[model samples]
Target: MYRLLAVDDDPAVCRALFDYFSSRGFFVATALSAGEALRLSQTPPPFDCAVVDVLLPDQSGLKLCQAIKETGAAVVFLSALGSEDDRVQGFLSGGDDYLCKPYSLAELEQRVLARIRARQGTRAQQVLRFGPVCIRLDRRQVEVEGRPLELTCSEFDILVFLAQHRDAPYTQDAIYRAIWNQPGLDGTHTVQVHVAQLRKKLAAALPEHSLIQTVWGKGYRFSPPPTA
Candidate 1:
């Protein structure tokens, strides 16, 4: 089932979304604020899409949309402000679609479904394969020899970043900043710890292969297997 997160401070709107999407066979999760929306996003089985209101009590939905995009979920903005500049700002914030307030729920549903379908359609091109290991970008899932591999959100993001770059090396600070979406905060130790844990897990899964390689004085690199 496609999972969705709806973030709107209006209780009526939240309830309507929950009810409408639920009836349409979607697993809907609603949050009344950006903080709540972020908290809900941390849960496993990440959301496939998020519907966010432009204005929120805690923070702007544009900021929240950027964070949601980090989870690899499509975002659609809902707003009462329908000006061209407002729509442009929404798209700049990584929103896939925008709907003006007083909108039809049916049309909203179609827009959301269309974005989900588009993401799924691109899944084939987004997948990463290295021998028995496979990474599905659309679903944010990793498998080894057809067995599902459980990983934390950070670990998965780190792996995806490195795997996409293939043989290119990345410093620990670079990886940390990229994955955490933060700048200048000393993440070397934290990155090392996560990379260590990730390496241990990968090693345990594939004893004969080393996918994440330590680049001596540099940092780390994803070295695909020779047969890959």
Candidate 2:
């Protein structure tokens, strides 16, 4: 099951999302404050994503997203303060998506599923197969020769982004802009760290082959499957 964290100061909103997502087969954890959300991040593995309200009891959702990013969790900001700046800040803080207030439950489910699918490193009906590794997007899991491979949040995101456009190269600037939302100079290292970490994990899990390849002076791309 995909586990999610729903952070909001309003008890009603928290309960509503919990009940809504639970019925749709998601295991939802509710936090009434940014402090509580921070506490939940310390929990062991299996936490897949988060939905945070911009206005919390003591802190902004953007701030909470920063904290969650350290734990490598995919985040979405659902806020009443639905301004362009608010959404941008959410992304800058490492949120995968931004949602405005009074959102439909259906839309929420779709976004949640998209995030989960992306994390599993799959998209649509086509299972991503690179070398000996396979990923099931709908199931949100990665497997190497039938065994599940553990991946951090960032690692999974990087892998999925690459897998989605196999054989297509993406520059460091483009990848950083897509994955890490921060701008200017300092953000450069963020993508590099994530890519390095992801590469190491993939190497450790499948050493015989490298799925993600460097493009000399360019950037990186997912190598296409070997021709039969």
Candidate 3:
């Protein structure tokens, strides 16, 4: 099982993440502050991945992230502050990914899984191919029927998530959680809007309508190509 170290001051957040990821077949250890994280990172075997809050009680998460990077662990920043500058700082601090606050556990799981897959080298097939659409994991590139799809960062992320789990029915709320990473925004209509955009762009590129299908009260699923 993969091991993850999570650093956050909020006990509730830490507990939620620890339980959520653990239930998903991960060995997760929680740290309530930067000091605890730093101390844990120095131990033998270390941790395979880390989820860090941008703020900590003892020190800044950026600093903690930097320290964790030195340990050669994959770093993901989870912050309440979602500024471009903040994200840039996360990357500069050696973090591989950045997630804003109020994030959904599903989205967090997706990002964490991606990082874990990357670290596993040959075991991680980061690319997903459906019909003519191909998504390259490392380069973060997407192409449909040989034509590149110009998608915003979040759009691409959502598509990648759906494509990877094609045909699996998921709710709009669940999709929002996976894509936007905003948990409390459950009843919000943001997910529908993004899905519409995703479908429009993908449909224009691909020769298919069932690429993304709504399952009525359930959510969306990536439909397979019809047999010729």
Candidate 4:
């Protein structure tokens, strides 16, 4: 009996998700706006999963996904924009998965269920360090100069992946396949946005080090500093 949250401005989509996922044994709840969804999560038992639409009346679902990702709920982005960059933005925003609009209901259910199961997977023990930044995988905490930094789940995961494979260059497609665990990921730039977000946080945390660098046509690589 997993609790689910569905957010969309369209009444028809809202009803459809509610009715369909409910039949699938999810205790589904609905919200028409980002603010409404945030408010709903403020009070009670948090949702296990969220199905969010990118185009919403109040705010972009990307921002909403970042807001609630730390709650440990799986998020799947639903959007009409099907471009590579658009899908990348959805993934970069900390969503566990992305489904373009005009998608089949069956496919959506499969994605949503997969995301939920992925979130429920076991936690790994890993600690990565670069300068003053420290990432504790067991607790999923990121700290810089002994201070904590707020990062979305996707951002944290991307940084961990790069750090674990220091000096290794991975094309966007390769990184996307590894992180999303999907074969032959279609969206080209889907991995770039997440890397960019991680770099931004690293910049703020460790100004002296570039941390991740572009490899021209090769892709991106993690640059770790000399160990003391």
Candidate 5:
């Protein structure tokens, strides 16, 4: 059975999907508001897929979708507003599928299942493997020599940013803005520091592998050396 999170303000909607999905071999969890949905996501063994109503009492479902997608969860937006722009915005907000209200619960189940399979396929692609080091973005797991390796919050976020944009150049200011969420605000040479710390950790883990490449004049790139 797959884990499912269903969020909607209407009690009937939430209970209906919850009961239906649960009957369809799914362990479903229902939340009346976006805040409840987020709280549920914080626990271990993250939800494989989330069915969220666009109109929530607390927060926007699209925002929840974006937040959970960063952790590798598939999102399906459920809303009454069915327009071209609404659907487009849902997709742009990281929703895998958008379903209009007055829709079939059976169809929602199928869409959720399809999203789960799609997420499985996409997760493999998001992983970064360099020799014995493996970074699983979906799970936020960093492994060395097939074992989990603990990393600082800053180190993990920065490393993932570089890997996702491999072969690209990013100055300290850009990285700071991306990781620190301080857009257009530059401070000290912080990128220089965390990069070195990441390098040191990598060196200690995989002595034979070179994962990060320094582009002189530019910032840096994540280029894992080819295996011999």
Candidate 6:
């Protein structure tokens, strides 16, 4: 069964969503604020999709969406702010879809399912192998030489992104935007830091092969050994 999280400050809306989705076979959870949603997100078996309101009691839902994206869950923003800029900001903050308030619960369900389906489609190749490194998309796992390699969510995402586009050099700004789904407002320093950490981990596992290559004047690329 698909796991769904619905976040809205209105108890009525939350109850409605819970009832609507639950009746349709979704395992639904509801939260009234961003903090509560974050707390619930920590539970095992991560949610497949989150329906979040743009305006939250404690924090902006855009920020919440970023945090949820790091967990590899699809996010849909539901808001009364229906302007173009609002929708743009939602997408920039890693939201997979944006729906205006007073939305049809049916439409919301369709949007949520669509986003989850899109994500699943992208991960259709369940396992990706690059020499001694193996990525299991379904399980969100990485193994090096048949031994499990622990990687933070961001690191695993970066690895998969690079591996999918093997040999193509992407600038730090590009990589940051691709992974975070936001413009590099504070520069690409965060991407640099994550890449550095990821490289260090991979180096420790594969001493001889350099799977990720940094291109001077460019950015980075996944260049596994040819024999793999």
Off by over 4 Å in 1: 122-228
Please give the lDDT score for candidate 1.
0.86
lDDT of each: 0.86, 0.77, 0.78, 0.78, 0.79, 0.84
Name the top lDDT candidate: 1
Model with the higher TM-score, candidate 2 or 5: 2
Model 1 scores a TM of 0.55
Candidates in order, TM-scores: namely 0.55, 0.55, 0.53, 0.53, 0.54, 0.55
lDDT of 4 by residue, 126-208 (tens): 56677777888768899988999888876776677677666567777756644553545574676777778888888988888
Q: Evaluate candidate 4 by giving its C-alpha RMSD to the native, one decimal.
A: 16.5
Clashes of each: 0, 0, 2, 0, 0, 0
Better of 1 and 4 by lDDT: 1
- Worst-scoring 10-residue span by lDDT in model 3: 174-183
Regions of model 4 farther than 4 Å from truth: 122-228
The RMSD (Cα, Å) of candidate 2 is 12.1
Scored by Cα lDDT, where does model 5 land? 0.79
Q: Summarize candidate 1's per-residue lDDT along 16-52 as a digit string, tens digits.
A: 9988988876667889999999987875446789999
Alpha-carbon error at 199 in model 3, in Å? Answer: 53
Residue pairs in candidate 4 whose N, alpha carbon or C atoms collide under 3 angstroms: none
lDDT accuracy of residue 113 in candidate 3: 76
Per-residue lDDT tens digits of candidate 6, residues 1-228? 467889999999899998998888676879999999998786544678999999999999999998888877899999999999999999998999999977998999999988987987754667888777889976889999999988997898888878866756878876665556444275488988999899899889887988889889988889876663
- Residue 39 accuracy (lDDT) in model 1: 83
| Candidate 3 residue lDDT tens string, 50-156 | 99998899999988888888877889899988888888988888889999988889998989878867775634466666667678876788887788888877677
